[model samples]
Target: MSEWMVTQGSTARRRARPLSPLREYLRDTFWFAPMAAMVSVFVVWVGAQALDTAIVEALRDEGDYDTLDELLRFAEDAKAVVSAVGSAMMTFIGVVFSISLVAVQMASGQFTPRVVRIFVRSRITKATFAVFLATFVLTLLVLASFDSVDDPRAVTTVPLVQSALTLCMVALSLLLFVLYVNTTLRLMRISHVIARIATESFRVAASMPVSTGGQDDAARLGSATAWVPHEGRAGVLRDVHIARLVRVARRHGVVLRLIPRIGDFVVPGMPVLAVHGGPVPPRRALRYAVSVGVERTYHQDLGFGLRQLSDIALRALSSAINDPTTAVQALDRVVQFLAALSRRPLDAALHRDRGGAVRLVQPVPGWTELVDLGFTEVRMCAIGSPQVCRRMLAGLDDLLLLVPPERRQPLLRHRELLRQAVDRSEPAPADRAFALHPDRQGIG
Candidate 1:
């Protein structure tokens, strides 16, 4: 059972990777372009026949091919002309259809199965096909009429005029198709160029350093202390048995002001927030707070980083709203932001010496260590929203009372401090009221 489970997990991971470039190209080309071409061919054939009929009636006074023999000969001749003209028209229409489909797909960032379905529904393929068919039918009708001209001299003039008209129609169709195709293709290429630019910008942002301090920085670095339960169970983590932890230390006193915001890259042992001024005793409480806070901060940073990445992806999809180059530049900025967030370094400055020789900082005291352990467990509670954070903190305050008096004294003190901080941090009720009543701000 264990082996099977492991194999299944490995298979899922393999499936998650991005499709190969060759596979992507083939899928798009075969599904989108070829489908459009087929539709265009059918349309061109119908259109030529319709145009041929109209021209024939306009040029000829009456029907001359009354007998079966004359009618058969005229039919053969007309078929030849229609087939020739329709083939050329189909080619022109196919090019335009293919271009338009590719352009829309590129702009939308929908290089997936779902996107393909939407493209088919857009009807560019069907519309082009219909137009080509109409043109073909019209051309064939006109060519058939010319075959009935009686006088020898009239024969030369009528056929000559019909051929000229047919050529004109074909030329116009080809010209229109080429122009449309070129415009669409250019737009699609522009969108792709913008996406590439945005990707590069993100890479640059990720390369920037998160801290500049030498060994001193390590002491300031935060620590991931515990896991927390998630608020809801309907989405990504629902029924998954995993929860997202918040930075408890961040809430207590420390805060992360670096890039990537939160919810980005976070490893188990990384420091996620900076430690601020605090009491030395109740070492256990401090340790617990620090550990929980560090974990929470990392989780928050990870979330923020992921959000930024999503924004960049969205910008790529919206390239058609403006010039492709301009969009690319905007996306580049988003990418840079993401890069900066992900480039944070591990803490390496915990051993800074105040004077002569460098000395190791002592491990947190036992009492403080115990407090830190409890804090770690609480942090794992995964309080995400501000409301949840408030609730969790409130619950911790009540729970601390259950601890024996000796242990509880320090914790109770810290809990009171945390409560006071939360009170001070809460936005003023008036501010909330004002937000709800925009008119109070003098807005019409």
Candidate 2:
């Protein structure tokens, strides 16, 4: 029997737990019910006073009980109606209060005070002004009602000072409302204007080209040339085209350091890498330096294409110098081809000349050959930063240009290797690569 009783008790406890929501709702309604009752009391009081006044006035004027009795009966009926309305309102207020209490309880631990403060501050000013205006209007209506009262003793005349005070309150309320609306609209307009100006300024800044220093005269150029140290610790070049320049620098036995790693910013007139081993020809070094500066600026302006072009040109130039057969004619032919391509009308077909004449030479085959030779890489990197890898790719492209068509596949394989190297070295964000975790549950 004791074990049976224990099992029953457990069942009862579970049943009780399910009713907690209803119980919580009922508890919350208790506090707000009284407020509704008070409002109902106020309504009844006003109605009863107005009806009693009408009945007394009618009785005194007509000297009859019929109308007075009828009015009294009507007032009683009205009272009953009002009482029913009041009771319904009380129930509704209770329900609302209960729901609010439950909501507050649910949020108690999680609610941030700072967020609450922000909400309160935003609404308090507007709510206070509304209350003040309502009070002022009510006061004016009450003063106007005094003039309509039948009894002379009950209808007291408002003093001039009191009348002025009432008028002042009404005026103040109107003024405050106008001020609030004006200030809010002005602030919103100013904020929108400022935001637009800031957005335009940022767009302009991002589009502007990076600047570089220029030598004013031959004498200044000569002075700038002296700034390049004859002997110093070699520093690695940070630019993407540095690899190509390294090869050129290597031939001259200058200790050329190709700056490895990424995100290093180089300023104008700053040495990207320190040259060492021996005194290199200042004129040749200056030319390389100036070319590099120009390439960097171009990359900043035109993006990766022009940088690659410059790199390829420099590499081709370097290779031609080394080889006996191709040294003289390689640069001239390439330059002539480039000039012709640039001058051709945008709509002109490759197969025909501008005057509908048969072309003297096919441009596509030559262009393809140059591309196959690795000249494309130099061309792309020429307009970019003169980092070692870029310069090296440019050299490879130049070397490819000299290679026979049959050997193009091997050159392409080498270019792929260089591209892989560059990809591996470049810095990238981790979040962009792969996600480690997945969300397990749905969120509202």
Cα lDDT computed for each candidate against the true fold: 0.37, 0.33
TM-score for each prediction?
0.26, 0.21
Across 1-444, the per-residue lDDT of candidate 1 in tens digits comes to: 233234334443321222233433343343554455445544653464455454444444454424333434555575577668867766765665666666656655533222232333333444444445446654654555454545432332233334445566566555556555554454345444334433433332232222334335434444523322222211121011001001333234332212112223334444333233322222233332221111111111222222332333334334333222232233233323322322233222122222322121212113333343323333322121233233334434544544445455645554555445444554776533332231211222
Q: Could you tell me the TM-score of candidate 1?
A: 0.26
Quality of model 2 by C-alpha lDDT: 0.33
- Please report the candidate that would top TM-score against the real structure: 1
Q: Report backbone clashes per prediction.
A: 73, 38
Question: Candidate 2 on 1-444: residue-level lDDT in tens?
Answer: 232234334443321111132333333233333344335434543554465456466565666556544444544444344334434434533443354344334222222111122222223234324434343333433333333333423432222222333345446545654554453333233233222222322222222211111112111212121124312223322123333334445555444332212222344455443344455434454343322221121111212222233332353345333221121122223332322222212211111123432211101112333333334443333221223334344444554565556545745765676455444544453421211111111010
Worst 10 residues of 1 by lDDT: 237-246
lDDT of 1 at 62: 54
Residue-level lDDT for 315 in candidate 2 = 39
Give me the runs in candidate 1 sitting further than 4 Å from their true place: 1-82, 110-131, 148-162, 191-312, 315-444
